[model samples]
Target: MCRWLAYSGEPLRASAVLLDATHSLVAQSLDSPMGAETVNGDGFGVGWYPEGAVAGSIPAVFHSVEPAWNDENVRELSRSIESPLFFSHVRAAAGPPIQRTNCHPFRWENWLFMHNGFLAEFAKVKRDLTFAIDPSLYPHVTGTTDSEVLFHLAITHGLADDPVAALTAAVDQVERVGRDQGVLFPMQGTIAVTDGATIWALRYSSQGRSRTLFHSRDVPTIREMYPEAERLSQFGDHAQLVVSEPLNDLPGLFIEVPESTIAILDREGYHHEPFRSAA
Candidate 1:
């Protein structure tokens, strides 16, 4: 398993959450209390839409096959860049080889996708799953990880038109294929996807117990709860975050997203709904 986070709201330096927090994504990479693996040092990646990006503009990505905590470039770049929406992920390479191409926040056109879970027995169903991708999109499948294939599968299933539906379909395909091959638990993990404007985060697993996930409570709500917490002043009323785990120990600061649920964040704020795959 890996760890990831998605941010959507006011423009802010990526480092604010990726490095500056008490349990920032970088910190989680070094020592994650809730992750299946404590150290996710295989590699890391960041994808962000520039602060003033025009509509339909694609996000930029920086990937490195280096432990995030040891990568000087991760700190430098994150501090310099401000984005209204972004994604950061640290990998633990369950079975795939560590390489730049295998990093998270995989991009296609204006959309970015990242996963914190895996498809069980991927090798058994890798061929079937890969072949199921549309030929036009299949060529872009440059990595061997199941995460990348899952992203493309979502695109093939209509991610651009309807992300929640597309993701459900993608999971269904993976489970159907895996079960056919005799894997009882075909899928397990949390996923986040964004198109520079809206973010959709999902927590699900074939066994009904997915990895942990949480979204920040609205900024105004947090400020009201802790009137003297000056740190909360930096955020605007609309600022929100969905992460693999809470960034800090501040009580009521984060709300755990329910299992088998999809959390959607946009200008309207977070909305969650039950998520189920046909399989």
Candidate 2:
């Protein structure tokens, strides 16, 4: 239940999409054609936003409990750190506990988040959504995943003023405590977030069958429909990507993020709202 990718355009090198795409993101942690596990080796993370900080601060994470395809310090720090905002994940430990703070894009203060899905009955609705988080963001939820307690319950219900209504109020507080303890389809995958200047992705679940997600159909309109694929002339003019699949296999390059959407990329270009409570 893990596979993630998020970026905010034009700085390149995080292996040009987390390891030179052709299904990269470290080759989908070893072949994940839309994961429910096809070898997400259970521990990986990468977070960026460090190229002269000091604006709002906080964005420089690099976790590993090994197995981001055998991390050699995540391939020498994703080819020597370059950023325009980033987030990466590759773990499939369904219920949690693999270590390294449950490896993900979870951070705060300049935001960053990640989740692939599953909160369904997280040990009986995880103590009523962890005592309804907000005791000053409850010691920054140092890990014990229900995807980092749904990213600190969307930073205590207000991810800097409406991140899809703070993630639909953390899925309406986990569907009002997993439907009074019956827990039908509580929630499922696909969530990505950022604050190093706008980026948010979400697809939904609650049994509407949500899983696979994709994006990246704008890189100058696939560089004028593959104008001789010069690696699509190195991304800019609002480069975009929201991946959970399709890193390459051209033919009009990637789309399909429906079923309760939210996808909004920055630097202007790419929108798709309507997951406002499944509309």
Candidate 3:
């Protein structure tokens, strides 16, 4: 899979979250303690809103086939851009080639999406699922991985309606077909989808034991806990983060997203509810 973090709240430099944290996303590229692979250096990407872009406009994107630790562009861009919402991902190739098209922060208009797990035995179900894609979205399916396909499937099914239900249908479609082909544990992921403000992070898997997904506790709580932590002062009261793992080991810094749950984070604090998988 991969390691990624999605954040939204008061606008701040993207680098502050991705590069400056003690256990920053860049550091995770070299030493991601929580993922199955300690190092996710295959490729990386970052997407964030522009300072004056209209609501839901395409956020700027930077992707590299090089390891994140070795990429200068990411470092420069992260340090310069300020966004209220952004996504950064460092990948460990899970059966796909290292190419820009395969990199994450996949987009459809104002929405941005990233995935950090796999569809077990993808090769077995590739053709069937590809043909199943809606003709309207088939051309936009530029990547071969099941992750991108899942994103488009969600779009095709209706991301504009109910994102949770659309994603549920996408997973159900994958699992339903996988079962017919004798593929076990057909889906697993920690996905982030956002429209600048609200973020929908869903964590689930057929066999459970899905990859780790966590979100920071409210900024006020964290500030009170570590009054000396310099970074806490930069954030607003509603600031929050949804990450693949704890960015740092501060006590009560992050809360584990429960199994089969969709965590909704916006200007408000955070809310978790059991995900009703709909397919």
C-alpha TM-score for every candidate: 0.99, 0.34, 0.97
Q: How many residue pairs clash in each candidate?
A: 0, 2, 0
TM for candidate 3 is 0.97
Alpha carbon lDDT of residue 145, candidate 1? Answer: 96
Give Cα distance to truth, residue 140, candidate 1, Å: 0.6
Better of 1 and 2 by lDDT: 1
lDDT of 2 by residue, 1-279 (tens): 888888777777787878887788888888896677788888889888876665577898888888887888888889897877788888888767889988998888888889887888799989888888888888888888887888888888888888889998888778768878998888887898878888889998878788898887877667878889888777776777788887787866888899779888877867889885531
User: 1-279, model 1: which lDDT tens digit per residue?
Assistant: 899999888888889899998899999999998999999999999999988899889899999999999999999999998988999999999999999999998999999999998999999999999999999998899989999999999999999999999999999999999999999999999999988889999999999989999999988889889999887766778889999999987988999999999999999999999998898
lDDT of 3 by residue, 180-244 (tens): 89997888989999877689999999987888999998887788899998867778887789999
Supply the TM-score for candidate 2.
Answer: 0.34
Enumerate residue pairs that collide in model 1.
none
- TM-score of candidate 1 to 2 decimals: 0.99
- RMSD (Cα, Å) of model 3: 1.2
Best by lDDT: 1
Q: Cα-based RMSD of the predictions, in order?
A: 0.7, 16.6, 1.2
Deviating ranges (above 4 Å) for candidate 1: none
